[model samples]
Target chain A: MKFLVFLEHHGDALEKGGLGALGKAAALGEAVGVVLGEGASALAPGAGAFGASKVFASEDPALAPPLPQPRVDALAALVVQESPDAVLFGASVLSADVAAGLAARLEAGLNWDLTDLEVRDGELVGKRPALGDTVMVDVGWTDAPRLALVRSGALDPVESGGGAEVESFEFETSDFSTLATLVEQTQEESTGPSIEDADVIVAGGRGLGAPDKFTLLEELANALGGAVAATRAVVDAGWYPYATQVGQTGKTVSPKLYIAAGISGAIQHKVGMQGSGTIVAINKDPNAPIFDFCDLGVVGDLHEIVPKLTELVRAQRGS
Target chain B: MKIAVCVKQVPDATVHKKIDPATKRLDRFGEAALNPTDLNAVEEALRIKEAAGGEVVLVSLGPEKAVESLRKALAMGADRAVLVADEGAAGSDLLGTSRALAGALERVEADLVLFGQASSDGDGAVLWAAVADRLRRPLISQAASLEVGDGTITGKRQTEHGYDVISAPLPAVVAVSDAINEPRYPSLKGIMGAKTKPQETISLGDVGVDAGAAGEAGAKTTVLELGPPPSRGDSVKIEDDGSAAQKILDYVVERRLL
Candidate 1:
């Protein structure tokens, strides 16, 4: 019944999805947090607060940002030493690579991209949209170590009771191969707030003429205490970083409240964000594709609506 | 450079899928094919071979049916193909899968190993990196654009922030992305040529690997349960009337969506 969690981090602090994954680890017997790379201890208290019984870290300095395959190898080695019944990973790209790699190292099947999950018959049955959302796939590994990749925002991460015991296990050493060396890393500080943890997300699309016009989107995002997202076009134009792009080629986000402005919803975009708890779209084009998928569709100019809404929100918040 | 591309068969991404009541998962009933990404890797390997004059060996460890993908690789111009078929290898998890593939690769002398970012079904995208680890080689992943000249290689690696140029020495492992190149269709002559080509198959013992370490015991992740997809919601039918635009706008206001 043991559940092991892979805790993702942003420079020593736990990531939102990692918190979500930590919450998921609660159901699996004794929870262990497997962290990769340097400065995994800053996450120790956060991991304990989130619900890990023990945190295991690989403090390898050669590990690069984003590509966590080396960490996967370390986790696999850990699984060999401590055979947990289940492993859970956040559905972010870096975590997914680590999860899949660790799962391969363990010869386990993965229930991936799950928006919903439940334990039935002593098994974790995971569900995800498949085939353009045309069909649902329930993925579970019967004979292998139970592995689940839960999407961010799919589960609410609350205080997991005890700021539990933080036991640090020495990384069972192995001669690491193909050390994923980071030749370069470009990090753009997000404007408003971190979107993965944002309860509300304000998204823009090609309708916003220039990258600076994204300031208005940021204004709306600031008013809502949310993060600003952009479509594939915005990211392609290099107006926004790829992390802020919510679409097929970009990050798949499932925020609770999503407000899309001046955006056209392509199926690829819809696939990424349709899981939002609530969706509202604003665009001047009556037939803009976003209207089809959003819970609330506004056929108007975002330039007009966004500014007015920002004012309303600011007034409501007494900011 | 001796390059090996590990490919897997996947259900075409665009195929219509149905949920299997028995499995409670997306029922890809009968229409699984080689992962579209593998073809991209195959094409990339062909391009690399065309430029560098190295042999491209396509290797996959799956059931006997996996040869279909190997044939496609050969059709795509891979110089050779290998299928490692064993029942114990069946239902191999990511680690065991990578281990088995790595074992097979040990038998072949190669300078580079290539793989797609990931297979569509597992989408875990772990094999190439894991195999690279198992092979004890330098690894680079998510390369969207690649150029090989002399003893040096350069590729643009995709990241959530943006792409960064990666340089690696020879005898490196790389996983290519679908954006790298379009896989070409196998001409009739290529198809005919693949039939006459040779493919080597090896065993778990011969490759010098542990059997228990592979298959289920090697896996660390597991699927907990299967659930059907969320029910499709009521469609917001846009009325064809030209003036319905105003109604949509009003609906937008009522929801406080502005």
Candidate 2:
């Protein structure tokens, strides 16, 4: 089967989720990738190493700043021209729009909230989480060019060291499609890597005693070259920004190493970070629900334990 | 500007959900309430109405029970409410739901349409875009803040790194994020006044949408199987003496991660 994956970028580099989608598509069958925006041409080659055999790029100036309508037009044009059996997307604020618009434009089927995709008996099946992530359901489309939107961080990216044949695609948009204009993009100023790109995450919860005490998690994260995250409880308490919140209602993260300090592992929070490779939870309450799922659980006062841990990591890193 | 806010009646998130074994779908017969995020959309619409001096209309699609959500929106100061309820509208996916809503929205004259980013129950977060596509209007989603002036709508959309400032022409679809504003509680006087507000209940035929083109029959995706999530198994607990942190470091080191 032929598959086309939409690649998302920050106008500088391709995003991990899009690369992950490409990786999955490559595993299934023949895969192609498409990049859109002003700097899209530069990102085409990167997908080749990850799994795509052919990369299509549309670099109109109007496609800059990551707006969706122009991208929908660009992608719809590609779909009509290429007519791939399936189109895959990684969940993001922008790609979701493009995927939805493309689905409506083509009158095609879009199965979203998917965690995995596979082909069985010559039919494509998508797996999705339902009933608040408590269960997994198998979903299939009634027709093709099947559209699937995978959850963020659902797939791990693997590089194949293969080169891609680059091609350029063009799209014509109406005045209504170009009505939305992106004025400026301002990133939140932070010292370390953002949570999405971080391999290691040190997250805090209400057990931290107070908001200012987040410095403890930050110190350890800085020493370990990781990022800091927080539970919805602390974020809702005005202790942290919603961007760093990890839970059902917040952003889902699947880091290489995740350490939960002073967090009680509620199901809402667990659903978000359960995909982490290694989970180490520190809480004074031994019976905390988080202990049921974590790989290693430490029972103690986070205030004393976290500071000591930070010092040790700092000494080990010699920073 | 005349505004239309899309509200949905969803099972309360606080309630434990049950799945129908046969259909593999969530059982909505339990206690249902207005989606919390839609309350924010309603609040945004009311604010836009207060600022631009226009009427706020609420639209919903579901079973007859969905009217409860519309009434709550009316109580919150929406000038009017429209309920599109049909027996065949059950099990409609995001696309079908958007189609039904677009049909209802066409009946009213709206300069702007607003929706919550996502419903707590579905969490798909793509309905507004579909509605916009069906209506062939501009869409701006995940708006953290919004402004209107000179026949245009502008908003700041939150992103992983930061936020993007985007502007679109009027008569666009806007989905507000939870951070936009705090929803207001309906006053007693407002609740009483809402009872007198104009409300109309229409069926799929009334909106010119065929029953076969929506709800379960028109669903683009079908569920093949439903099962509990994979278990993580049991975990190991460690008593934190003074060396607890060292053990963690050793664990990380053992895995060659550090």
Best by lDDT: 2
- TM-scores, chain A, per candidate: 0.92, 0.92
Model-by-model lDDT, in order? 0.71, 0.86
Name every residue pair that clashes in candidate 2.
Answer: none
TM-score of each: 0.79, 0.95
Each model's backbone clash number = 25, 0
Per-residue lDDT, model 2, residue A48, is 97
For candidate 2, write residues B1-258 as lDDT tens digits: 899999888887788887788777778887889988899999999998898899999998978877766788899999998999998888887667888999999887699999986787865878888888888898899998999988999999987777889999888999998778889999999988888899889998887789888888878878888877766666678998888989888888887767
DockQ of each: 0.29, 0.67
- Per-residue CA lDDT of candidate 1, range B1-258, in tens? 788888876665667555455534345446567876788888998998898787999888876767766898898788888778776765466667778888888877677788885565645555675676567666677888887857667777776545766767767788886667778999889999998888877777767767776655555444333444575365454432344334534554465543
Candidate 2 residues lying further than 4 Å off, grouped into runs, are A236-239, A285-289, A314-319, B254-257
Ten-residue stretch with the least lDDT total in model 1 chain B: B237-246
Candidate 2 versus the native: TM-score? 0.95
lDDT of 2 at B65: 72
Clashes of 2: 0
Model 1: TM-score, first chain: 0.92
